[model samples]
Target: MNEQHILEQRTPQAGRLLIGLYPARYRDLHSEDIAATFAEATEGLNGRALLREHLDLASHALRLRLRIASTDPAGRMLAGTAPVALALAAGECLSGLLPSLTALATTSPQARPRLFAVEVVLVALVFIPWIVALLLTATGRWRRARPVAVLAALIDLGVALVVLGAYDRAPGALLRACALAALVLLAPPDLVDTGRRGRWEAVAVALATGVPLAVLMDSRVTLLGWSWYEVPAMVGFWALLVVSLLLLVHLSARRPDRLRALGIALGPAPWLLEYGIGATHWVVAYFVVLIGGAVAVGGVVHLVRRMLGAEPA
Candidate 1:
């Protein structure tokens, strides 16, 4: 039999589904060639091996469609930011889950069956997809996670809007949530390895996200209880602190590319959306001062490094 026939035999139905994920423009030009190549490569693979290849292929296809698989600095920047975005989504799920569990514990389902049922469904809709996506990304299957994350974000946005309209809550929290969800959806898929460093980075991100989120959720003043309007500013401050510490650590260790560092900085910056887009103007000047201070400090740092010959002029 010819190679085409052989390829047809090897390509499973799921493989065709992956190829179909490609854009129509690209598929029209090269789907057959791509499919045939994939089939030939996986001709003898089966079971877990085949599934692994399928996931890898799916990730490649997603990166292509998202236009984020390039080796260029922009692509690298997005790749760096994407994993953090997933971690933040996981953090949000954790944050929301706490209140949900509390409500379940305090409220009797038999006393208010309909209300309890609705709450359960809402929690499932808004949070489960994010947790699932986080699990997938943690396992290094980011391409498959992206679509699931997107679904989670949509559910979050929808629920936020409903809560805003029905309960008349301050839009600040909802808007910030929407902004963070948007960031998670737009970020490219992260290409992570099952390595020690990758595992550590994952843990660090989870801590960063969880710590700030927990602080914000606190209701007691001694524990950092701040109003919803204050959340953005608090998150922004935490992000800046983390960035400063990272910069200092890098100075003593191996320095990262400035551009990639900037991208990493952005992973913690969704809070800026509150003042900028959500119009929580009370914290506007606070961010301005923080930004100005950062710029001035960076200038001094660069000048000192140049004078000391630690960095290229």
Candidate 2:
């Protein structure tokens, strides 16, 4: 039989649908080739072999979609940031859950229902949309993802504001607000199509701006007396700092821009030192403070060079 006839006979309806799952541009470029390959691979296969073939096709389509998405700067940013966002969301949920559960268990029966209801709403507000947006972004659904992410950020900011009000500008509240605001700012809009370098630069700007604000707002006086909740909160805070640092390193390597790398690196150092000092780790805090001072000076020098229209050394 001819190749066309063979392909038509071997390619199942499900295989066609799986291929269709890829973006239209991708399909336009590779659909025929992919279909032909599928037909050839599945030829004369039955039952388990056919099922495996179908699974392979679906997997290939998913990989193709992701590969296509990775080509876009916004998509890359979304992909890189999604994991961290989800991790933060999980941490927040856990933090809320522990206290809420304790309150529920301790409260009188009459108040238990009210506490449980409030906890449920709080959990929903804190987690659902953020998690959904991360999943959607991972799957290459940027248009649908953007609004969901924005809603999640708004909800998180509102919660942070309430915490700030109740606790008189708590560090945790400020950090939460800054983190969500950073995410909201970084979350790519479908309208503006920027390149990878542009996206990384945007990330650098967001971190450089947000990190200092968070650091300044962090009232470290209470760190001498640690609460159980502070453990998780500290872990989340350090995780964020580490991620931001790694991102800066990546951008510095990938792009030729040194100014952004310097700005981001310098901006967070003082904050880290302050955290160490607040936690009473003096040796480390002193060491970091020295390093931060040097980097800050270097950053200042770089800024001066830029002002003079000279390339940074």
Candidate 3:
């Protein structure tokens, strides 16, 4: 293009594009001033000045995006929620399956009345708190939600009292089972506290979970025409209880993997200990010693790492 066209078109238009990046209120008054400055500054430059202007504008937009993304709390909350969302997926799966099985077993003619009582109790237990908490949430009473959970749990205790009024046929097995489920639903693992208190909390939940699992296994063994092995079934139920308790101990001590490792170690540690080389039940004692020693060593390593600030400073 010619000099008059170049001054009139290229420089002024290119400068206007740069000013467009600013908010409209800013550009409305300054656009023409910026265009004039550019027209004067680049008056003698060739075509390459246009390319330099575009590159500068693009870099500015990217910096603004990074600043906003990092500073927003909502963005951080979403990142945290991803792991919690995964945990909820697993919780929901168990909830759906357990309730369905309980529902199915309760449908039989003999099982119906007992199951109905259980459902009534469970419905009261689960729905009442869920409703009250929901209502409080709707009215912006979120600060009171934890207290509401406690109060809701108390009301469910009243439901258990109502169940006691009937007292039919040696406590009606299904009702007992459903009551157990309601207790589980009312106070899930999520409600438990963290740290020192968390240890006991973990143990209690493990005990409660173990009982129902044992009962379910007992019932399963009876149902699948395994009655001939009734003795073995009861023995197996007890075995599971012991294993679960051991698991609970490991969890309480903050060594879940240690519990699994204990089993793996049991197979190999006997030979390593040469059957403990002394004492009554010496082979069994070796496992207790090995697991305890390993955990102590791990704790020492952790402390050293913490002191060195190799963990988190």
Candidate 4:
């Protein structure tokens, strides 16, 4: 055929190749419509115009693939869990630092320098990789983030093991074990494609859950050593936890992915351990009880909805 006829024929084939990059289900649903659109868009185009059309097609295909992947339940779960894990780790690091600093302050001047140096090294080992992994995950670089997160968890577990050997404390050891489990669960081997919106939402959830707890811990508000206002504050904290757990359960049920549900359920474990075992705070323990109650309530809600043929909240 003539050059124009040959170019027109080739353009549709190129468009098909680009569209093939989409997920199989997506292609099955809309491939014909997409191909027709592509052919219509590229009609009479050649040289630079043709090149620009192909570039746009390729870019659109890539974006569609990413969007589909990011919406997967497993991927969303990993994205949601990462920020919460990082917040817990930051809190643990800060708690450890305070005691180390306090002890170092009382040491002799020469001994202080040596002790402080050790603390600095330990802090670097504990925090740097975890922080880098958090940044990578937040920015939607999941392929790189997974390995870094795993490395951070390994280093943390090693540090915890060393501490357990030195101190032989059950509570501290148990907390570390729980933290390690959380990190492992959050960092699945497969790349989790979380988009910008998912990353930001995860961050917001983490901050909302963690900031208040940090404030309480820093202010030393314990149930045992309660002030007049502390009783009301404890009740408020318990209510918040119950509401949070109910929301999490509702969201998880809607997604219908067991891993996502489990990840969200375990999101509070580190904080629970912090208050329940490590710090032994009565208020925190009571909050844990509220979580259990919320879970039971969520179960009843789910059952009622199912019976009524209603959608999960």
TM-score of each: 0.65, 0.39, 0.25, 0.48
- Residue-level lDDT tens digits of model 3 in 123-203: 655445634543443343433433443344445345545654464322332332233222222222222222343333223
| lDDT, model 2, position 294 | 45
Model 2: pairs clashing at backbone N, Cα or C within 3 Å: none
What range of 10 consecutive residues in model 3 has the weakest lDDT sum?
A: 81-90
Descending-TM-score candidate ranking: 1, 4, 2, 3
Highest lDDT scorer:
1
Superpose all Cα atoms of candidate 3 onto the true structure and report the RMSD in Å to 1 decimal: 23.2
TM-score of 2: 0.39
Model 1 lDDT per residue over 135-235, tens place: 77667666666667766766766776777556544355466566565554444445333356544565566566665666566555333455744554555
The TM-score between candidate 3 and the true structure equals: 0.25
Off by over 4 Å in 1: 1-31, 35-67, 166-194, 222-233, 239-252, 278-313
Better of 1 and 3 by TM-score: 1
The digit string of per-residue lDDT tens for model 2 on 2-31 reads 765666566788888888988799887877
- What's the lDDT for all of these models? 0.63, 0.51, 0.39, 0.56
**How big is the positional error of residue 197 in model 1, measured in Å on the Cα after superposition?**
2.6
Comparing 2 and 4 on lDDT, the stronger one:
4
Clashes in predicted model 2: 0
Candidate numbers sorted by lDDT from highest down: 1, 4, 2, 3
